[model samples]
Target: MSVNGDSEQQDWPRPSSSWIDKVLFLGTGTSGQVPAIHCVTKPDFGDCAACKDATLNPTGKNRRGCTAAAVVGRSAGDKQESTILIDCGKTFYSNAVVHFPRNGIRELRAVLLTHAHADAILGLDDLRAWTMGGVIQRHVPIYLTQECMTVVEGMFPYLVDRSKSTGGGDVPTLQWNIIDKDKPFTIPASQGRKEVHIQPLPVLHGYFGRSSPFWCLGFRIDSFSYISDCHEIPADTLQLIRGSQAIVMDALKMDRHLSHFSFAQALSFFASFSPPPALGLLTDFTHRIEHYATQEQVDTWRDGMLAAQLAGKAKLSRSVGEGGGTKWWSDIWDERDNEHQMTIRLREKYDPIDDHNISQTASHYIPPIKLSWDGLVVPFDPRRSPSMP
Candidate 1:
């Protein structure tokens, strides 16, 4: 799908009063998830970060799970605000249990999809539990491209086949809303006088130059854009999200992937979009986020990142929402992966958008990227955010 972002920002939805800013990082590990059942810490890879993290944090945020998150209405009063949930992945059930309890949800308005990847859509079955016995039950809307919708339907025939009975327990009640990548759509606002309009920014999900590009979506909702799984962000799509202050994207692993972003690929994508400053999802972890050798791209990036942070890289870490407190991100890491704001600033200093810089960045990356664990929530402002020059 081709989307022209000439002046699409006008279509963005205004913020509402009923919603809160908190984005709970539900799951951040990839498909196999961290602490893979078949993980070996020595032979092939080195010390297991997943196992180490699990040991240190235990039930805390250092623990990783499937990818997903919940955005709740931030309120302390009597009125229970509206609830809007993003992707419901494989670990969404467990991750939700860990992160969703903080913001109590009264009404679930819609479900947005990045793509119908299992790591992104598996927990859809669990959505039934949310509607099981509510006083005013509602069929949550599932928004996605027709291709994705068909896949979802194929996976769960009973969801659409009315004649099919729910063997015993409750099945997820849903309202399938087919989405067009070229057209922007609006969902009921949770806390504002107006609705929240989400613009789809279509980008190629794999390869720099593939025989047939696997084009997928990365959404632009105000100042924040989310691309859960993708390998390449075309020039046009980059321009659309360039203005976002906080952009969350897929950082499957430090390794190269087939259909997902590798360490360098994700960094390059982030570099193009970062407006002087910007920072950054999830999927599998077992075979994906393998032990990083000292020479791995992620290790290099991490080392460079630490150095930049120590040297006072632009203060990129900002509180995402009102109630999230400082520990929110780590708790989630205690939960997913993405880029850093430093890469943007550092790349600008490295050189202008020249072939040399792009070449340097692209040279290390081997295409056909795989992905990692999921579960993360971040904050962003659609209206008031900086833009790339």
Candidate 2:
């Protein structure tokens, strides 16, 4: 299939100018991310499944690092169009530059942070470079749950410091807007006269054994909802996203994970919701899985089994109206696997994408590269590859 370069920044299966506005899955990998600096350094490091096969990776000409999600509206004549970002992971800047270049994005209206994990928020520094160019004059509004804000302040003291009189630092010139979990709020849209309502849907993070109640918030933008780093979906939260046109969520692979959703878990979650017009998997992978092998093997498996079952047995219907009753067959699964060992089966009639396995899966199988024995094959050492680490 011919890949669309702008699909990550534009709405999937539809153009950006579509009725529901634009929702893009900028970055979907897990904490360590794919083609990790560690994995990339290995001597036998070959091509990346997501990059070479999935077609989800950006073009070779302009490669930015990290993962992120962006939502843009269709309002015209608005100079400062509002663009919202969820989870500013370590690769935020490079990912932003690649998917949303300075010229493409006119304004950086707000940011909603799900938690304080390094992969989720380290890219805040890259905003410093954007400010120097004069696109943003004041601190951009950063929305976070009270608990998450505390974690950010503790981790990146300089960025959240309210004491700095001059407001000059590596931070992305942000105006902190701390939000309460489960509450809906309004953010000014592209046109100052208009505003977009965003509802924060809270979910769990981390593993059960070491499970600390880390707060992760998903945003409901118009008909689209974005949720990442979640373990379970509460009934109320599911209600909130019931009729959403699209849901960009975390599918950490096919394995049964302690914290995140496995492919089966994600599919189960998707099954519960009224099928949205589109379904894209974000925060979709990790580094332990073999990109190439997984994609080919899983696609073959999905076409033969999962797709047939869904076509034959899935009873859920899609919602009706612009944002009302659900339609059973409109469900779309833009599955992005990131965890290890997780495998997903597509519903019957759905043709599995070639790069489906580029992301993570719940299955615990190790990649060929990592299975080497001493002397026979040298293990990949991160210290040797400067591109990574």
Candidate 3:
């Protein structure tokens, strides 16, 4: 599907200088956060770094759920500040409380939701606490896509219900503004002196049973775009973010899956948007692909992309993975090569097992795999026999 260019620009309010300085990446991840509830509740839950502390490494595993919000506008100090939250996942309330403390923010302006998934909107109730306690006394305006609003009202009846009396004198009230996909809207920022234009980019979520359909979306905030829980990135959406400074997207894992973009797919997507300032993969928290696997997957994809360039489909002129705190793409690729050699050397250290049976039989038996800086592989499996090949 393509975006209507005419509609996107028509009636668009001119951006003010005050709005330019605001924006921060609040949270990033898929619906089920890292170190999921099951992980923490399981009897044999090992001492995982993420499990040990929630704030130090706020990932999908350690955080409440997968949601990101950005705040916009200037702070009370009159410094230009504007933040926008991409998704409001289950732990949004607590995460927000910790991340954006009362002393830190002068206002909690708008919340933009990417989709209607549970992890994205479950924290709607928590805003009430902020409202009731006189923390954010003013009505907070929430902007959502029309499709998302339908799902929100259907899923959260109480929040949308105007008749119910919130026992706490006056609960935090929400003003909903339905955003038209075809048209862009400006949110008041910089203490209402500036406006930030938000454009909705349509994407495909997993299909529903037999005949029904579900819609997912990503938002383009000026030069940055955030898309999570999507299987495919539509061409039109790509066009909208053609020159983005950063594109934060979902890279579920290494292997191909039916409903999500595997790490390879994510790399392909990044290649499609070649030469972007930076690209970050989020919404990752699966045991199948541990931290090492995630980095490996990234390396594999980068290598593949580089290889494809020989045939001319890829023409990356700048260094990849360098802009972000992530290592340079060349460094990662070099590491991958080193890792391959190390894997060969360690071959005798691991018992050869069928790939298909590895998950069912040896997943838990094996310790976490570590990827060396030069790309060497070390099998931490204690079950390895000296005679093993």
Candidate 4:
């Protein structure tokens, strides 16, 4: 479905009281997560740097859970803030135990599931903590596509149809709402003046063939968009999120995979925007991605793109390594893949339009492209803090 784009910065009205105060990155890794069992438990220890770092430092940027987030805000005239969980994945319980109390997230107002993958919906049973024993006064509402709801019903029959529950100490009371991928819907209102509006972005995740592709959803809320998993975004879906102020996209690893975007692919998409998003963060990473090294790699690419725009160059010739190499990028460059070619084409098409915003200090037009870690918190408004390391 098409949602209006805020092409011009002035067109976005500043909210006196932000509808969304902040977004907390509950988890930022793929289903397997960081510090994989084999990586740390091997006799000689595995060679994965990200997993090793996560093992040594229990609470570090290298440590990550599943890809999930919480949208936190207090609607107008509400006494308490409402938290809408984006995805309750495999590590939802562990992630919530640590972060929920630390961030003052007491109650879950609603849940929005992107899809019914194990990493996205396996934690449905854990919501019993809030629903049982009258911990939460009312039944929790969950919104998902009809296909996803069907999967949930199969996986957690007790959760969907309470009559099927047997010998249950306590089961979560829930209300299911089936959503349409082509429609934009609103979260059920609480004691508030406004309800959060969400736009569903259906994109390809994986496929059996050209005609039958697995559908995964990305969501658009105000100026923020989150697509935790995607292989390709259709042209129409791309237009829906064109002028987003802040975005969290999937960049699984340095190499192109069948179902997810690679580092360069995500970078190319981010840079294709007119002025680029104010804040562009990458998530859903794999073990191959070491936290600090990936950050440096992204910084180098973002800098090169900004430099090309500033110089009015049609191609990027900023090679940083010796023998015409470019450090980390050179190591992962796949001549067989078309990612490099796509990057060049995007520079030729969108670089000229960003000329007016590019300057000697090019941080304004060039969004900070960060490899988001677990527990990283960012303001929902891009104008408040546009750049965060």
Question: Which RMSD values do the candidates have, in order?
Answer: 12.6, 12.2, 15.7, 8.6
Per-residue alpha-carbon lDDT of candidate 3 for residues 98-156, written as tens digits (9 for 90 to 100): 54652255456577777787877877777776566566545667888887898888877
234 in model 2: Cα distance from truth in Å?
0.8
Q: What's the lDDT for residue 320 in model 4?
A: 30
* lDDT-sorted candidate list, best first: 4, 1, 2, 3
Q: What local distance difference test score does each model get?
A: 0.52, 0.52, 0.50, 0.72
Writing each residue's lDDT as its tens digit, candidate 4 over 1-389 gives 00112132232223212367777889999999998888889754567888888988978888999999988876557777888899989999999998887778878888899987999999988888888886765677898999899899999998988888989547888889889987888886766546767788888898856678888998876667789998888866776775567778898876678999877767756654444566788999987688887776566655555665454443333643211122223322332253544322222222233334454445325566777778876655423422111
Best by TM-score: 4
Estimate the lDDT of model 2: 0.52
| Alpha-carbon shift of residue 225 in model 3 (angstroms) | 0.7
TM-score of each: 0.65, 0.67, 0.65, 0.81
Instruction: Name model 2 segments beyond 4 Å from true.
Output: 1-12, 15-20, 46-65, 74-80, 132-135, 162-172, 189-193, 207-212, 280-282, 288-342, 345-389
Query: In candidate 2, what are the lDDT values of residues 147-234, reduced to their tens digit?
Result: 7777777776776763642545444566788788888887765435366567887777654465366557777766666677787766
| Pick by TM-score: 2 or 4, better one | 4
Candidate 1 lDDT for residue 271? 31
- Candidate 4, superposed: residue stretches over 4 Å from native: 1-18, 208-211, 315-365, 381-389
Q: Rank the candidates by TM-score, best first.
A: 4, 2, 1, 3
